[model samples]
Target: GRQGSRSVPQIIDDWGDYGAGVGQVAASRMAYRYAWSTTLDLE
Candidate 1:
């Protein structure tokens, strides 16, 4: 799943204008994952 998900952003990033959009989406996903893991660690 991780490899597949990572490839998706790379494909989007190759689309010129969509590169920035993909970066934002990837950053948001990373932040969400970090927050979720932190919450899990707190439990």
Candidate 2:
């Protein structure tokens, strides 16, 4: 989640726009934290 956020600015710069994909990536990573916390195998 934090890593995704860190890359956001770089992604925005690379793509030359603040678009939906960046938001999706960050959101997905944030959600993954919950899953990882709940399951040892996935983690």
Candidate 3:
């Protein structure tokens, strides 16, 4: 979703709150998927 979790100060500066919100949502989704896949919890 995001272009890697790398910090893009320039983009944040350019896109402002809207860009930050999109990135935040994307990063959170990616993190959730990763944790779910890597864990061994059956439930």
Q: Pick the candidate with the highest lDDT.
A: 1
lDDT scores in order: 0.84, 0.75, 0.82
User: Which residue runs does candidate 3 get wrong by more than 4 Å?
Assistant: 1-14, 40-43
* TM-score, structure 1 vs. true: 0.60
Candidate 3 or 1, higher lDDT: 1
Per-residue lDDT over 1-43 for candidate 3, one digit per residue giving the tens place of the 0 to 100 score = 4766646796677689788889999999999998998785755
Q: What would the per-residue lDDT of candidate 2 be over residues 1-43, giving only the tens digit for each residue?
A: 5744656677667675556678888999988987887797665
| Model 1 Cα lDDT, one tens digit per residue, 1-43 | 6654657676666786677788999999999999999999999
The ten-residue window of minimal lDDT in model 1 covers 1-10
Residue 19 CA displacement from its true place in model 3, Å: 0.4
Name the lDDT of candidate 3. Answer: 0.82
- In candidate 3, which residue pairs get closer than 3 Å at backbone N, Cα or C atoms, i.e. clash? none
Q: Against the correct fold, how does model 3 do in TM-score?
A: 0.55
Models 1 onward score TM values of: 0.60, 0.42, 0.55
